[model samples]
Target: MDKRPSVLVIGDLMLDRYITGTASRLSPEAPVPVILYQSNEDRPGGAANVALNLVAMGCDVTLVGVIGEDAEGELLLSLLLSPHIDTSNIEADSQRPTTSKTRIMAGAHQVARVDREIASDVWEHHAHTFLRLVRKMLRPESIGGHPFDAVVFSDYAKGVVTEDLVRKAVENARFCGEDGIPVIVDPKRKDFRAYKGATLITPNVAEIQLATGKSVGSNEEASTVAQDVAERYECSVLLTRSEKGMLLCDKENGLKTMLITSRPVSVSDVSGAGDTVVAAVAAGLARGLDLEAACRHAEVAAEIAVSKPGTSIVTEAEIIKREAAA
Candidate 1:
């Protein structure tokens, strides 16, 4: 039997398209540069990116989210399938088009971004169906009769992760008994009340400020803010500070803060770095690592993720190579 950790990711799904070209002159119609066509690339985004990062780290991943019944949705599914991510629980919505973000890049710089998505909450029936699917996937019989080791909520505030979904997930974990799995949340909403009772929530400094109305400029300030947020949410908090690294505070640990310094690397792009961090942390927690160790692993993963362009994934090999070099 394979002992690899199995992770279930639930949230919004999107397609990230990069249109790269050369820009020599500005468009007469607008202030934007005229990008000469070069090439285009597409990759899974949002929660799907979390699953991709987990898979690259050699974990068994199952992704559940909502996508449209359009061609963009088909393309997104195809890309996910290519990575061997289990998309069996993804539901298609006919009322909205698939969420897609197209970045117009000139050489290495992004010139403009075009977004296509429905910002409203999913329909009531869709939410019900999504909850049903979540319950089914959480069952032991869903994947070779083995329960998932971890559950990740990758919320983009795109409406796939509803308050009911988060509540149901917590209830499901409780139903799993003593081995109650860890539920990790990558929160994006300004109001984080829905995420209460989760095992851990990984939010960046800016997100922390947005949710808690507190700014984190230094290590001590971040620690104070993390404790406040953790107490409010009644769970552990991993506060990701781009260059300053990560700060973790948990009530289980008596709210004693732990800091993990960031690894030195030249960042190429910060897109999807949050997803990578949460994925690494989830994988580590699923494999039974402590929060501190998991956060350390996540820091390394984030370092590698930002070193690449666009939405990228960090493999186990890359982590090993970086470790050896360090």
Candidate 2:
């Protein structure tokens, strides 16, 4: 862990816009709260937020995804550029507008949201360019003869993370000689098989149920379903169970599930906590922590992330501080 661990992030990227104002009365046209126009703000969302988390934890990140040929894309690119984050692989497609969610907040509550996006696979040229970039990064001689330590697939189901694309990416990353790069998935796809050759999959209770068609209301149920998905998909499972902590099961450890308990705190908005969890796990693996240890680190990172208001960044120092107190 002497040098910075370089990580590659690929998936769906979106822009989160918020327009907050005061609400005094209900709208006459419809049964909705009337929000007085105040101000507008935008933030990098989805996979972009995952990149933010990785860079905050001191990892060098290369972000790959598709955006729109619009001003929102321009603003998102500006927000994503940093000393540690390389946004060169992010493509801007003219076929669709940038995926964006604009929430109208009345005082402290969100009244309504407007989303603009097209849910479809990446266009042919975009897909080819993405594959080329993936291949380039996998090569040891690509940039400074340094291959990525880990790859994070932060899927938001916005059509960027296609099955064929994931298959090719996983194949290349898993077979690049003896020291294979780890591919971690923060999956939004209902089929876990789409990420068959991945090293780890981070799914919450809701996702676990949908992916496996099972009811996971209790810890035991979650364990059963998690194992089913892990073994079936040929990948390890890092099930994030919110207040119940996390469960880690993998073939490397004989599928012995370990529950990494969540440190209880005052819960705020859990908007982008998953992005932080995936970023922390990828960064932890890059820094040489085993799966269980890395998951423990993610538990602490997510705890800190959820305690803050809306989607917020947690720094390496903050995580270290929280761990020391624990």
| Top lDDT hit | 1
Q: Candidate 2: lDDT over CA atoms?
A: 0.87
Cα-based lDDT at residue 244, candidate 1? 86
lDDT of 2 by residue, 139-214 (tens): 6543334368899998999988877777877887865546677899999877788999789999998998888889
Report the lDDT tens digits of candidate 1 across residue range 17-39.
99999999999998888999999
The local distance difference test score of each candidate is 0.89, 0.87
Q: Alpha carbon lDDT of residue 222, candidate 1? A: 90
TM-score of each: 0.95, 0.95
